[model samples]
Target chain A: MPPTGLEAVFLANRDKLVRFLTARGAGDAAEDLVQDLWLKVAGRMDGPIANPLAYLYRAADMLMIDRYRSRRQAELREQDWAEGQGPEAPPGTERAVAARQTAEQVAATLAGLGERTATVFRRVRVDGIAQRQVAAELGVSISTIESDLRMAAHALAALKERIG
Target chain B: MSQDRNSPMHGVDTVAIDWALRMADPARADWDAFTDWLEADPGHAERYDRAAMTLLDAEQALAAHPDVPVPIEPEPVRRRPLRWIGGAVAAALVGAIGVTAWQDRPQPYAIETAAGQTRRIPLSDGSVVTLAGLSRIELDHAEPRRAMLSRGEALFQVRHDARHPFAVQAGAVALVDLGTVFDVRLGQQTRVAVAEGAVMVDPKGAALRLDAGQAVTVEGDRLIRSTVQPDEVGGWREGRLAFDGAPLGMVAEDVSRFLAQPVTVAAAIATRPFRGTIDLEAVRHDPAVLGPLMDVKVRRVASGWTLEPRE
Candidate 1:
């Protein structure tokens, strides 16, 4: 379908990208990457592309993989930075390391949540935007937007339950 | 209704409950059309009131248990969308009252898994989740356990996390161990199969640590564990479920994914387990080839099909 809106694009890719990402490495990573993807898709120069859903999701997946690599590189850089910082700074470095790991894990998990819902949820929750304007810009009714939130909430809740 | 809005949506009307849950959630545009519809006259509001009471009761039960991670509606998401209404709804409600008056929510995770329908869920966590046929899991996670597999079997290859430890709760079985990959099922029976690392299979207060190359079947509180190769139990990860020496009923449960709803097997044949591998790609197009092999028959029932073992 033509990508008139970001919602259609995000939904089409959400399932496929989840499966695709899980298989790659970031299985249940985080909502950040997905959010990032949505933002990128929405901000893309391509106003309306062919197979918008598939193309956007593919880009998100690629971004996820890149994110993974960046994380790895950051970890290595940190390790190298620590080694160069002398043996005197041990305990302080350890705490920093732990905090970094937690943040990374959280980021990965957020990224895994994908575009549409992730963006909507984050913008509303993280940015605290009202839902009406969210719907207006996305060009959907309030009810449809509610459905997305409901679906995301149920899915996320289930995910938390299965693992926690 | 306010006092008991947390009750589980068991046997409750799906539509009203679903919408109510949506209303409670923070992500959506705050001005719910469904809520307006329900509140338009008063009859709709009453029905919503009834469902809301049950949902509230369920949430209360979940909230009582702190360790359990209840689904937290992202208020951060909710705060502004009401603003985005261009300040219409809020500007309207300002002179009126509290937030509780707003909800009209989604049915409490209205999941319907038939006896043989294997529904796969790719979670927000990036974890691949599969709900086995005839499984009915209560998506009531406002409690300690992330999910309560109320009446069926489910396999979870949990995304590893100590902070948000993945947990699968069955009646007498609670698998909340920290590990890489694991499969959990709770229905007519409770079982936990670990493909890697180790999973703590806790039945009531009893704890059993099942390591890689090990599987366990928990019937009631009894944890029956055995040493088995990880490969044997890891087939589900590949989208192919292999059943070796499983009874006909058991086999039918796994194979029913090929059908719409689960087709039941006779009580006599329920004890007759079959051994085979179900490949989605190979058999997805035609379940006919695989169904008859186990002396089972496939017949369309309503919009879906039912599997019947030849009489």
Candidate 2:
């Protein structure tokens, strides 16, 4: 079917909003969400949308609610799988620093490290992912991921030495 | 640093905490890159300050409990806002996801704001941003963890992203985010200020930083910083507006805020200078009359307008 004026409006906004919705845990549902909103906008043509962009944003937000419900279950599972007994440490102190076991305190110090180091640490400790998976996700060699993880560990240890 | 790793969409807090843990265990290649990152900026020291404090606390908590303390939600200061956000969240999820795509390209985060209200937002990549009033921040959540401070002010409690150093736009300044808790305010110019951490307030074309115990007010193209008391900067978080030797024109404008009517200033009083802080709303209701200064004259321009510099 040749696209209609209203359909054009729907088409125009669909791709753009999909990315917007993705941030709110709807990364996978951009398509379905866009379709649902198109129907409503067309149905409610009581008057032309004065500011189409604003209307489109308003509509996109509405679609996210349904998408969130469907996505929530998946998200909870994914999160649990990723986190472990990592840095739930007591705040950094000489004693706590000496006892350094929890991942949170270690993570805080890692704030000074580079992005890749932090990512490697997060994946290995918090997510319980293997070095290979971390490497693959970052598009780096598995050895590279392994190396980064080691360096982060050293930074944490060095931090421990300074304070502990 | 341009590491824009794919990251989580929601509940970034947990994701961030988790990542902090893994980074502590068996060192990885990413760690060496982090060392390079530390060498890249000077304020990296500030970034570690709070996290260091937290680390200290985590030690205490663990020593005492040997288990993760169940985080208690703070008592609600205002139920109305949360209820509104809850309603808005529901409505957006129902329809906003798609509409956003239709209007704007995919962004990391979609934000909505209320008049005279501010928010501290947590982005998908585990970075925290404090949003100012009437501002909208968009996040890409993709490689490089891109974000735009559409308008208003924001405080970025950025998660340490080595590959993708977070960035914020404060007018002419392209606030290149290092790991830190820094504030970006939208006004005559983008204001960059830091609290617990340091930030490189790179103005793209200029150089300035709004570091801890200091504030950088940028207007037009120039950025200037003045060292002030810590809480004096962004005091609104504590429900007060703090100012130090602020100009008369800006002070009066702030005083006349939130009224159904716009506050006016006459040419004579526009250039006068004043210094002090009072309740913004209270002053607007009953303005504290600015007594005359030798350098400038203050005159009543209209029923509510004040004119400075009677020249």
Across A22-89, the per-residue lDDT of candidate 1 in tens digits comes to 44345466355566667786776555565555465446534644564466557666877888964343
Model 1's CAPRI class is incorrect
Q: Can you give the DockQ of every candidate in the order shown? A: 0.04, 0.02
- TM-score of B chain for each model? 0.51, 0.52
For lDDT, the strongest prediction is 1
Candidate 1: list runs displaced more than 4 Å. Answer: A1-164, B1-128, B132-145, B227-229, B232-239, B280-286, B295-311
- Model 2 interface RMSD, one decimal: 17.3
**For residues B1-311, what per-residue lDDT tens digits would candidate 1 score against the true structure?**
12233323322233454555555543421332543454444344444444444334233333333233212321111111111211342233322322332343323463667643568766656555677656676553122225556666566666665555556656655566564567665545556676555576552244455555446665443455433334557465365776645667666555564445454565756877676677754555665666666777766565454556686
Model number with the top TM-score = 2
